[model samples]
Target: MDGEYHPKSEATVSVYDHGFLYGDGVFEGIRAYNGTVFRLKEHIRRLYEGIKVTRINLQLTKEQMTNAIVDTLRKNNLTDAYIRVIVSRGRGNLGLDPRSCPKPSVVIMAEPVAPAHGKEAREKGITAIISGYRRDRVDGTSHELKSLN
Candidate 1:
């Protein structure tokens, strides 16, 4: 994390990031409701679990990350919002190998969002389509770990 607040338009990540190159990263989607961050600890725990699985050496402790989330919210003067926390493999030379990356980049964004689907859809049910492609199994590639790509 850069430790500075930037406007959404000004926030930028390096093109050399391994996350952008090879999708080496993890993320969590969080919500703030009624002035409280819903399931904050659970979200942090899941994020750490992903980091452990990906073997990304995040310099900040879990508690610090949690505080950072709060700080970001305070800086933005927001409540009742959606928060996206992303930790991506840091910048490195152009190569598929992650060993070239020495750090991880963290970004947290908060914004207001209304429901995308209508209430009638929930009540009447929505159509579904099945695809031939399937996700990689947990043993092969953990679905629990969220990748930016």
Candidate 2:
């Protein structure tokens, strides 16, 4: 069967999915221009790095994942869109145990983005402010890992 053309109902995950359990996962947001996915190599590299750091086992070759992304886009007939690639801890018990979660879930979603005010925003200079909230120190959460807490 052609997985890329399947409906959303056909692409389902178990409720026991560990990503929902322990927030044990990493993801990348990528963009495609024309018909090419940009920075795909970098995105995959970071995903693997996160998996390694989190001790999650994943079996897909990078090429396979890349092809999947492209295939999905092609199936949908979309040339310019955003792609979200996620590798999540697979299904396991209710308890917070990484050992129970042996496999990792890989998902890639592609969709179009509304146009941003590109040059206008840059030329006019967008305004911003530091919110009252302060980000936690990187050391506190091993921010370098780039994985969800």
Candidate 3:
């Protein structure tokens, strides 16, 4: 998706993009309230921290990234919604080398969501969704980094 905005149906990334090819990326789930993004600065700070550790070279400053997210919410005319911000190592070779990627890909998405739970759970129970992603801990020790990869 890069820096430009597009309809979700038309959004895409190259097959060779490291994020797509190897799941090399980081993401944050955010929320908005009444036309204002919640804790946007904190989220941007944390996202940059992850970028620091991952060395993904997002090519956009934290401010730029934050603006993108806010703009996405506005574009969709969404409030009280769940937001997802993703940054990935851009197009690269089929090999495992990070050097192959130069620019990185970025995507921001938002949608209305169900409540976090409580009354809904008491009444209708809950549904669980399983993911194909597998996460492994080092020697059963937890890491501070939460990631999509």
Candidate 4:
């Protein structure tokens, strides 16, 4: 998961990853339209902000991350697609403390997806339900930060 592109079948991550073990990570959902990534800069900014909130030292800069996303799309030959970027606290011991994790893992995946509700929903809006639960207001776990949690 560390900057390498792999088929969905082959991609894997360590069980010790803080993200997997403790939801210690951040991610951004992005979209590409007509070969152009939409609001990529803004997404990158949000990602960095999340990293800041979580105190994760992502090795890549904002520019590098942006290039990686574009590169992933190009590699997959995807013009219009859904892209998800995840940066996770790397492998560590079973302990809950994050300091045991020395590095972070980065992953960029792109795939095509159709609208869940189909075109009819776009033409005539469908009914919906909203969750009553709200995220807690803790500093490291704030909903605004966007994390694996």
Against the reference, the lDDT scores of all candidates come to: 0.85, 0.76, 0.81, 0.88
Give a tens-digit lDDT track for model 4, residues 43-121: 9999999999889988898998999999999989998899999999889999998889999989888998655667789
Q: Residues 1-149, candidate 1, lDDT per residue (tens digit)?
A: 45778998899989999877778888999998656789999999989989988888899898999999998888888877899998987899998778789878898999976655678996998998999886776579665667666
State the lDDT of candidate 2 residue by residue for 42-139, as single tens digits.
87787778888888878787788778888888887878899877788888899887888877787777787654557789689888887988689756
Between candidates 2 and 4, name the one with more favorable lDDT. Answer: 4
How do the candidates rank by TM-score, highest first? 4, 1, 3, 2
Give me candidate 3's TM-score against the actual structure. 0.78
User: Of 1 and 2, which scores higher on TM-score?
Assistant: 1
Best candidate, lDDT: 4
Instruction: Give the clash count for model 1.
Output: 0
TM-scores for every candidate against the unseen true structure = 0.79, 0.75, 0.78, 0.81
Cα deviation at 68, candidate 1, in Å, is: 0.5
Worst 10 residues of 2 by lDDT: 1-10
- The number of the candidate with the highest TM-score is 4
